[model samples]
Target: MIKWIAAFLGYFLFRFPGAVLGFIVGSFLDNFGGSGNRTRTVFENVTRQSVSPADFELNLLSLCSIIIKADGQVNQRELDYVRQYFLSTYGKEKANAIFRTFNQVIKKREISAERICSFMVQRTRYEVRLQLLHFLFGIAQSDGQVSKAEAQKLKEIARYLRVGQHDFESIMAMFIKSADTAYKILEIEKTATDDEVKKAYRTMAKKYHPDRVVTENEAIRKGAEEKFKEVQKAYETIQKERGLS
Candidate 1:
């Protein structure tokens, strides 16, 4: 009853994620109704929507497959990277299940970027989606260089996911190295003063901090930490170049 109510209210107020969050909270409330004490639900974050592990894995693999196929021919390294990352993060059993689903469903059919982004926008948090973009960039760069086709596809995916231009550029900078890459990672302009650069670093540090991704799994939080480090590196690089160091 409570779950249904949350689903209704959440859908009306938010969207897919709202419903998921409602259900998770509802489960807690329902359980509380029966017993005085409450227990935690296994959906990634406590403050965010509860995306089932299985479902999240399936959809995530689907997205990876899309990226792998984006550049015409698939690279063994890219495929191995995805498999190895999942294996290390989720463990053998879960990774096996994820691959099974990938082969049976995701690998077989061509899932549209629109469909994936639509689900992500409605059901997931902005932070998670940002991490997703970062992961895709990793795939594009796995073959040593990100092809023009792969880069274009990544941009399309980011747009579909409703990622802001600055944020998109920020993630893109982490993979595509250039003279102004530092500024892009900080999501700032090149002409910004020292103070402004520091400010951007602080904002980005807080935004990409692993703590912000507590609702996600350990692997994903680790990924956030990696992103946070990139932001730190960018800031330091800028500081040195500008003689602030």
Candidate 2:
């Protein structure tokens, strides 16, 4: 039994660096943040303390790898984009942890597309799923335009995530609609006064307030939540620019 467990552990340790590393980083961050109890329930009810690092790495790589492949190439800019994003969102320590795991996962030669697809299909959170989609969209736009292959891959990923066609369209629309260079969110004109911003916020807040939108369709709820976040971020950006808040 000892030998058997040891062999199993070795196999996984060799196979799945990302999953194990993700679990470790996740667990460590959970502990560090001291809010594991209040975090997404997916981690809360997990039965096993020892998660396969490779599996976790594969999952993340699956998403990222697909995005890279979407453009039919993986350029330095895209790689830097992922690195910087992880650093900004998860901090250097956690990002390093994930990078270590991904490094191992990729070392396994000839990673199959089927396996990669399955990995993405299994892992990732519902809410985070949206964020991942957003990230993919961002990646697609890294070169100032998305390629046909990239577009199709994003759509395939969306389908795998069960994100409806309409939802996918809307998500893309949000990004595409902001064709301007202004940092302001909501895309309101630069000349807009304080009162105009206030009215826009009030209008959006009423429509997207979580409580108010709870009764709407799931797609609507999700869109509203994302939109609301955009609105809040935009409002904050404007305030900072005006030195009001």
Candidate 3:
């Protein structure tokens, strides 16, 4: 939710600055940009009304709490990353409003991970779920490195989200670098032929293309673009190792 959602929200808000503030649960805070800006109404309604805010909070916010608790201790860096991300993307007023709602959700009841993941797998698109994992890894790794406990929790979440092993490993390689990370990110064997390597790079590039998630918010698209960049980096690493053109 932080990275993808933040990226997409920032991108769309830029294009339509007015529609961005409508996210507040009730009333425009501190007033609108100007009396002349006509897009103000659109800003409030163009996004997420189709998707229930309560439902969105219950799932994504719940996941954030679980990740913050994953490594046996809550890290303030992770907390700040989540907070600043929302504040920067949604603006102070909206972000504070979201935190209010989030706090309410935490206080009122518990939403099981099984049900949350089930809702995600059944309701959200595959590409979005992929970005969800991408964002989750970002959270886990925010404090510098993802601990073993955090990594295990991530794996469990991936399985619950029904992410394939190859896809899961590909995303994992982006955060947890290793000698063979390039190969894993590209989903290819190091023993593959030169042509196979080229083909894998092409496939990954296409698969992670930002356009593939066009329907996603600007933040999700940004997350997809980051994966696309990682794919490019992985290809470059292999190319340099093998001296491919």
TM-scores for all predictions: 0.65, 0.51, 0.70
lDDT of 3: 0.67
- lDDT by residue (1-245, candidate 1, tens digit) is 76567545544443333344444345444544533211222122323454444444455676788888887787899887677665544458856866776665534546767776776687656765776687678777888988888889999999999999888888788778888999999999899999999899999999888777766333345557677888999998998999985
Candidates sorted on TM-score, descending: 3, 1, 2
Q: Tell me how far the alpha carbon of residue 154 in candidate 1 is from the true structure, in angstroms, after superposition.
A: 1.0
Candidate with more favorable, higher lDDT: 2 or 3: 3
RMSD of each: 10.8, 12.3, 8.2
Better of 1 and 3 by lDDT: 1
Question: Each candidate: what lDDT?
Answer: 0.69, 0.54, 0.67
Off by over 4 Å in 1: 1-55, 89-110, 193-228
lDDT of 2 by residue, 113-136 (tens): 444444444554444455557667
Comparing 1 and 3 on TM-score, the stronger one: 3
Clash pairs for candidate 1: 17-123, 44-215, 45-215
Clash counts per candidate, in order, are 3, 11, 8
Candidate 3, residues 25-91: lDDT per residue as tens digits? 1112212321223222211322332434444444566777778787777688987766765676667
